[model samples]
Target: MYHYDEYDRALVFERVAQFRDQVQRFTAGELSEEEFLPLRLQNGLYLQKHAYMLRVAIPYGTLGARQMRTLASIARDYDRGYGHFTTRQNIQFNWVELAQVPDILQRLAEVDMHAIQTSGNCVRNITTEAFAGVAADEIIDPRPLAEILRQWSTINPEFLFLPRKFKIAICSARQDRAAIMMHDIGLYLYRDGRQQMRLRVMVGGGLGRTPILGLQIREGLPWEHLLSYVEAILRVYNRHGRRDNKYKARIKILVKALGIEAFAREVEQEWQHIKDGPAQLTEAEFQRVAEGFAPPRYAAQPDGDLDYGTHLAMDRSFARWVSRNVQPHKVAGYASVVLSTKPGPAAPPGDLTAEQMDNVADWSEHFGFGEIRIAHEQNLILPDVRKADLYPLWRLACEQGLGTANIGLLTDIIACPGGDFCALANAKSIPIAQAIQSRFDDLDYLHDLGELSLNISGCINACGHHHIGNIGILGVDKNGSEWYQVTLGGAQGKASALGKVIGPSFSAAEIPRVIEQIVATYCAYRELDEPFVDTVARVGLEPFKERVYARQPEVSTCAM
Candidate 1:
């Protein structure tokens, strides 16, 4: 994890002081709500349905034990006893008091963390794969560049206020776990013919009312010019992106209005002047950032543990967990364990109690380096857990209700804090997610169904990234009543594709059964060993749509 230097510390503390004063002024009636809106948003404070929500950035989803402990402390002391881990690789305290926000920011600063850029129409948190350095198949570790982008964008005067919120994600693995193509700016880091690091830049990709996959704009971009290149892209968008309408303000809209070729041409024209500017990364500067993410020390152990295999054979439950929760690590004898936040009906998706956070933090230190990772899927990850100690760690995790063996299963849902908390939401997301999880509570059935992603967004904002889920459920407003619209064939990774809507929306009570019917339809149509997304793609959405709506009531006519 990247530790803050004096400069980082100074900037955060100063920002905290500034926000403290801003809050005081707003409370004193010296500043209007409109005036304080951006100020509070920049500091990661949002006035939600019932209370203020504070979103704290976990840079590139990496967290040290101390930072995790501090987050747990904040959750316990400042707001509710739990916090929701978001799809953006950040955490949200949903019940925070308005007056206590500065104190929260100050507390976060103490641990080299803050809510800066977590919200607002500025560049938000730069996210990457949860298993960046540890992934066995990763071509390069993206943390250094992710951290660089984080620092560069933080409070950058040029991009402080873009037409809309900008998001950038980097992925270096063969599998695009970072969902790079779904970002405003996505970078795929790789090497060229001369073994020189380069990037493949994708632009205009976003999920909202208008969901579109990013188009590759620039290829073989030298790694040294990352900052300058990004600056050029931002310059293009800032100049031409719509300012009149919030819905049309996104770079995706601009890119759509002007084709990718013209957009690329503009960016290229803009880049020539600044290509060799000071922002061009030097070898030394690269090394300085890279040093922060250097691999942790590891003990010499056999490539495969006999005891691990023995334990798996002995306990079917443990074996099932290993198959799902545990992922391959780059180093021998190490595994990355995903602690599922969606554990049946006990908790909503991504909601973790303060005690659970502290326990995971403890386990990160106990089982691996004192590090934790937040996956974009709203799960916690211990990136370097030893295979030899897997059983003990699994037992401890199970005790804490974090040992749900559904990593990519249907129940491992990715959902937003919808109408329950977010004022922007149209319908409640948590209850829907909980209902689905409860319906699919059987671990055997989930595993048998194979890998599947079910994502629900309360609205078209796509906060849950529903467009890329194998089965995407979006809450829609129909006569002031809660309804869900389902989509199929969406997928993330190397073959990322936006899902297509099946048909009409269904009522909230009909969602669980609709999902069950969808899954059943997939089971009937799928080829042997075919993944859910692949099956949906092969057969199309008609089969599932028919099944979901068959014998169903006329939901469109229903009123609240």
Candidate 2:
């Protein structure tokens, strides 16, 4: 929701012009592919298996209605009719033309959007919770600080090229919807007894070949030191992080090699050098960035609305949707509505057609403020929908295929494009996700099963964030064939933990049935009203593994 000032506009326009020339040079063969590689990557362009994929950044996952429409136009005009919303809260166009990229950048610039720092080994998009300011249980709004981080890091010559991609996430809510624990740097924003803002800093968290939760490096850090502390961590990483091996380049690996104590000492030493430097955030700057995210005007309404209660009582389907997809808001008589992008086999998880995008943009204005949010779980959000507008909005959303009642259920899976679009993928993730969704189409059953997450990744890159799902499925390569590996008890949020692998990898055809057995095993052993993850924690992985492998055919040994 932060509108670009003249400086921001000039920076984006200049970048577009520079990239246009670079693109022209490459097209004319004046620049070699090797020369163009980093240039293109810095601009959020990737050469995938079939075509170039363009990833556009949605700063802190906030989007104005106009920006959403612009994205829809790009999807319609430039690539295929649809775009994939990634777990990072960014959207990817899988089939983009090499020549039209500059034009696309220009279009994005018109709406204060760009792809800068989205793909390069730089600080990627600074993400926060989708329900940042509006969540009922929020301690303090994190978007202002998130925006500050974004501005400070964008194109900072000191950190233009790091050993590997770095990600940072901040959250202020009681529930961690942003999955901050799995980021390179995670910040929990809160207020102390005196209402002085503070941060709990975590570092060295990442998911790839090696998945590890972040270790808390600092607690009760004053809000003024947010940027300074982050810079100190980056300086430490830039100096000591491995550059010889890509697999070992992430800060997580560095933190692992050096124990947390040593890592903390190094960061502390680095911070002492820059603690009071220009990077330290100031009150004036904080207020300037925060003005853009100030609360929207609202009409005073009662705690309960008669029409809303009437609709919920009359329509069971609407009630089910409200139960699963709606969230409490900070303001009375309002709620945050999650528009699920996962709609079973009709579309892949995290994908929306141009038409759907346009519809959402329209609905955003009609229902609430002209704002939309992209969730880390690959869903769209209307953060301030009035309770009185719930029924009409739900009807409109249902008409556009955006109303799926499975928010944290099995079918509401988080998945990457996998082998279908990404060359780095060893196996196909889309089909597997579709297969699982198709198998678990019963909404009643899913709701009864309680909140569960199923995440899939095509490879070890963990693009789908499979390691943190309640039931994680990873695609593995076995003798040039694709095999699926299952991990149980993974979870995100406050008690985030990485999943443990079951015995062996199963063939693609066996994934659905394997998931079925896992679910059945959970149902058998679960205590009354226990969530899937809690059941896994109570019963452990042995029972699910026993049931899955008991009646299965011979399978290859675990390779991952």
Which numbered prediction scores highest in lDDT against the true structure? 2
Candidate 1 local lDDT, 430-515, one digit each (tens): 89999998888888877887888999999999999999999999989998999999899899988998889899998999888888
Residue by residue across 196-300, what tens digits does model 2's lDDT show? Answer: 999999998989899999999999999999999999999999999999999999999999999999999999999999999988888999999999998999888
Query: Which residues of candidate 2, in runs, are more than 4 Å off?
Result: 552-560
Clashing pairs in 1: none
- True-structure Cα RMSD, model 1: 3.6
Where's the lowest-lDDT run of ten residues in candidate 2? 551-560
Model 2, 328: alpha-carbon shift in Å?
0.3
Per-residue lDDT, model 2, residue 248, is 98
